[model samples]
Each structure stands twice: as structure tokens, then as C-alpha cells.
Target: MPQMAPLYWLYLFIFFLLTLLLFFMVNYFIKPFDNISSVSHDTKIIYKSWKL
Candidate 1:
């Protein structure tokens, strides 16, 4: 089997780290929006109930 170079390993490691960082960043940013949307939905439901 052919062996990979050390530089290639380093590049792979950097790429993996970048992807992991992006994943966490997306999750972190998205959570607040999700909470906001859910809160708004709940308020809408409450408002609808009040109308009845």
C-alpha cells in the first residue's frame, strides 16, 4: 500500500478542525433563532386562545 505524506496529514487535520468549528458555530447561531421562533409560535397560540 502507498503511504501518505506528513504534510497531507496536517492538511487533513486542519480541514477536519475547520469543519468541526463550522458545525459548532452553525449550531450556536441557530439555537437562538429556534428559541425566538418557538416563543413567537407560543405567543401566537396564546393570542388565538384569547380570541376564542
Candidate 2:
């Protein structure tokens, strides 16, 4: 392979970091049902507090 310049190294590093972040984000959203339950619970609590 030809020698890589400074810009190429920077681009490679950024691409790698973004892929890692994407993996974490996908893992979080992969289970939408769990998130829905937790979100609903928070909403219910807020609504109950408002009634007081």
C-alpha cells in the first residue's frame, strides 16, 4: 500500500469512532418494547403528580 497522508489517518480514525457509537445506539434501540414500558411509566408518574 502507498504511504497514507495525515488527512487519510484522520478520516480513518473518525470513521472507526462513528461505527462504535452507531453500535451502541443500535443496541439501545434494538429493544423498543422495553423502552416503551419505561417511557410509559415515567409519563404516568408525571400525570399522577400533576393531579395533586
Candidate 3:
């Protein structure tokens, strides 16, 4: 039977967790920008309509 070092497993787990954390962090940061852009677009449309 071959034995694997426990630290290798820990390293793999930490790497996977970091990857997941980074993905969610990027998603979280991107959502606010999308909302801000959409809100600004809506406001522009509203102002244009109001002017006409």
C-alpha cells in the first residue's frame, strides 16, 4: 500500500478553497459595477424622457 503525505492533501484543499474564494470575490465585486451602470443608464433615460 502506498501512503500519501497529509500535508499534500491540506495544500490541495487550501488551493481549492482559495480558488473558490477568489471566484466569489470577483463575482461580488462585479455585481456592484453592473448595478451602478444599469442604474446610471436608467437615470439617463428618465432624465431624457422628462426633458421631452
List, residue by residue over 1-52, the lDDT tens digit for candidate 1: 2366877889999999999999999988776666767867776644455665
lDDT of 3 by residue, 1-52 (tens): 2356677888999999999999999987776666767867876644455674
Instruction: Compute the lDDT for candidate 1.
Output: 0.80
Candidate 2 minimal-lDDT segment of 10 residues: 43-52
Q: What are the runs in model 1 whose C-alpha is more than 4 Å off? A: 1-4, 32-52
| Full candidate order by lDDT, most accurate first | 2, 1, 3
Off by over 4 Å in 3: 1-4, 32-52
Lowest-scoring 10 consecutive residues by lDDT in candidate 3?
Answer: 43-52
25: Cα error in model 1, Å: 0.1
* Residue 42 Cα positional deviation in candidate 1, in Å, after optimal superposition: 6.3
- Which segments of candidate 2 are over 4 A away from where they belong? 1-4, 32-52
Clashing pairs in 3: none
By TM-score, who's the top model here?
A: 1
| Native-referenced Cα lDDT, model 2 | 0.82
Better of 1 and 2 by lDDT: 2
